[model samples]
Target: MTDASISHLQVLDWGLLIYDDALKLQEALVSERIAELSPDRLILVEHPPVVTIGRSGSLDDLRESEEAINRKGASVFHVDRGGMATFHGPGQLVAYPIVKLQTKDLRLYLQMLLETVAAVLRSYGLASEFRGRNPGVWAGAAKIASVGVACRRWVTYHGIALNVNADLRWFESINPCGDPDGKVTSMERELGQSVDMAEVKDRFTRAFCRIFGYATPPEVRQRPTERPSWLVLSPSCTESIDRMESVLSWLRLSTVCQSARCPNLGECFARGTATFMILGTICTRTCRFCAVDKGKPDAVDGGEPERIAQAVQLLRLKHAVITSVTRDDLPDGGAEHFVRTVEKVRECCPDVSVEVLVPDFRGSLKALQRICDIRPDVFNHNVETVKRLYPIVRPKARYQRSLGILEYAGKHGLIVKSGIMLGLGETEQEILEAITDLRRTGCSFLTLGQYLAPSKEHFPVSRYVSPAEFEEWAQIARSEGFKKVAAGPLVRSSYRAGEMVCSMRQPLKSYQSKG
Candidate 1:
């Protein structure tokens, strides 16, 4: 006989089915054929109505009784997926692939599934990812797709349940995917709109084919080409950055410059300057550009003030910049911690000037008073961007409230400073207006820098500001009555901050001497 031709290998089109009862029947059929099929078959099936319990699932998680489930005319079955219980009903697409893996690695197989689903979701204008330790495509903490599978004799059965336009209310009946507190969400929930089931199925099928190394069917391969740049630090700088970061880790402190994934982290760390993020890493409000984990606040760490002081002392920092996540979750927006931290830094490092970069405290005068009472050497609050971009750029913060905070600090005898990021789709006039607003607030110092996207998942950068433009902006800010201005590509609220503050103080000191 002629040598066996691999070119003659059959390329089977993925079979699609849409019915509630089809899941149980198809799963049983795939499981039965696992050992018998010479070449594994790939089947894509959609569920009409069902609840599934995975290997580690518990019946107690189900709010409805077995009789209640039966009465609803849906069946519940145990699955091999590595999650807890989940509800699948009409309008959800469930894909079951019964195929032998080209590679025997289960992890790689799972990654392929996730990438495939992510590609499909991208086509529909949804941004999603596989969160580490989480077994689904999440648009934050909400689950949009669930994957569960059983592999035996190197053949895979069971698969993923993607929530397209499913009624999410059904998921609330049980602790979805097992955790009682776990929140169940769908594509419709995130997008605030419905998607066509046929379109979803067709797009997903093409994604699966492309991912599995099969030639894409001509009709489904036209993917949108909008690649976002991934912001990452160079590996050569990791050692140097990590050495500085070791100090923060030792003190259990957080830095938004790191946590928010600032693009200039390497340069700052190499220079041995770090922006100390206090009041814990958890933020109260969710902003689109920020990467800080948002949720209910953590309790204030009383010892944090002293610890930060000790770190500043140990690092021999001549000027220390302290900042915090938006702590609206706290009654005082963590202003007390800011005050205490500033005080401790002053006490311990008597020669070190303290600069505080703080939130607006939800426009609370009392909170502003608490921080001002500490008399930080430099009281800096960022306007972040122009008023026009405020809603989209800093959704939870108010531009007026921020300006008020700066003015209040200045009026209270503190050296007030403010900064804004450019390249956020803001116009030059808007920038000039913002500079004028800062001046009206009595801000003595202003810093400006480009807004580089921290992650692809975050907001895209509208443009990058060149060095020459930054210098011109700095000149404009100075002419607009800012006592000192620093604007450049690498400029940040705390960039080369000690030198800048020292330069500003020299002129003030000389003027006082002359007086």
Candidate 2:
């Protein structure tokens, strides 16, 4: 296995893809796995209609000619797998495991694949068994899943495909596994009802991991729902997280990092950096996009600023980031509380630079001026999303009012900053327009991050913005005049806050042009 230790396996969902493209991606990941540049990964995807022939099969196995298959909208391929002939199409769940082999026995690996599929079927109240002579999972007399694989450099690809709710008619065209009398079935056919594809994938992932001995530690919480492998966090710093949480609890303080469920919590906590949240965790505004609790807030704790300042001193942070939940109930929209916190933090650590991601102050220029007057090193207010998505994403937060907050801070000679979340049903043109609008307000720093829905009740993610696209947007933001930009899948408004100042003092590799 290239002499690399086997860590916990990761699961990635590629959604819907074409067969050829998926194969190409598998080859690339296999190379990376062989070179020890990547860990074992399970790639989950669904492909369009197609038929594949394994090394043991020929054109005679096909019931129809190539032209007839094409007319049925199904293409055929000659693959390097060990099976005969099989059909792959929509409504079927395909799992291609890019894994480094721990043993050279291909038979054992195939047995593990069969056991995993059997376990998943058992979870859905369906009994499945593998007939060694048949080489696939069967329910009584009909095949419910297919197993085939290809290997290179001791890494395996082209794994099992389970029939979730696929139309079995496609199987009629090919004598499945070169047996003309073989019967094909699916989960829906066995249960007499369609099953939830998402749930089946979850069960299959857990079963596969358990069967392959890649189980996650009990201490680690499960990864977020349907997150791509890159976005999933395999937290290896539980002691650090426990220590930080304990300290925050002992101090009677709160952090935006915990309240917002930020993906960077483990990384930042391990490094002894956190964004303090003042004015309590409960917010008065009911913004649909935010994860903070919505309700009547608790009474403002007058000593909260001093406690926060103590935290800054104890953490010994060179750059402190403070943010809060929107509190429209307060007359000043909690501006005075923000001012007090900043003052205490500055008094406690004279050398530390401060940044505050504030709300819009309910369009109160006077309250906005109060925060601006403190002149925290950086002043930030996120427009959060494109204007067109405002009503749906943040019904209570006005887009124009947020821009005005940034503009007012910029006009007052403060280093103004703002942020936005992508994957909220916003188009490319809308994103560019949003960036231009922020630039017009003289926003010096910008953060563009992917929006992850916290739960099924929250807004669903329209798409996952890729890393290359984030970099391209960063380049565009720089050309649009944003002095510093942090754009990526896991980036948040206060992510890497210290780096912005450091970049100003010297060159940072993160901001350097890839070109």
In terms of TM-score, the best-performing candidate is 2
- For the record, the alpha-carbon RMSD of candidate 1 to the native fold, in angstroms, is 19.1
Q: After superposition, how far is residue 350 of candidate 2 from its true place, in Å?
A: 0.8
Which residue pairs clash in candidate 2?
Answer: none
After superposition, the stretches of candidate 1 with alpha carbons farther than 4 Å from their true spots are 1-240, 270-272, 505-515
- Which candidate number would show the highest lDDT if scored against the true structure? 2
Error of 2 at 406 (Å): 0.3
TM-score of every candidate: 0.53, 0.57
lDDT of 2 by residue, 93-132 (tens): 9998888888887889889988989999988888988888
Residue 209 in model 2: lDDT = 74
Reference-based lDDT, each prediction: 0.73, 0.83
Instruction: Write candidate 1's Cα lDDT for 141-166 as tens digits.
Output: 78888888778776677778888888
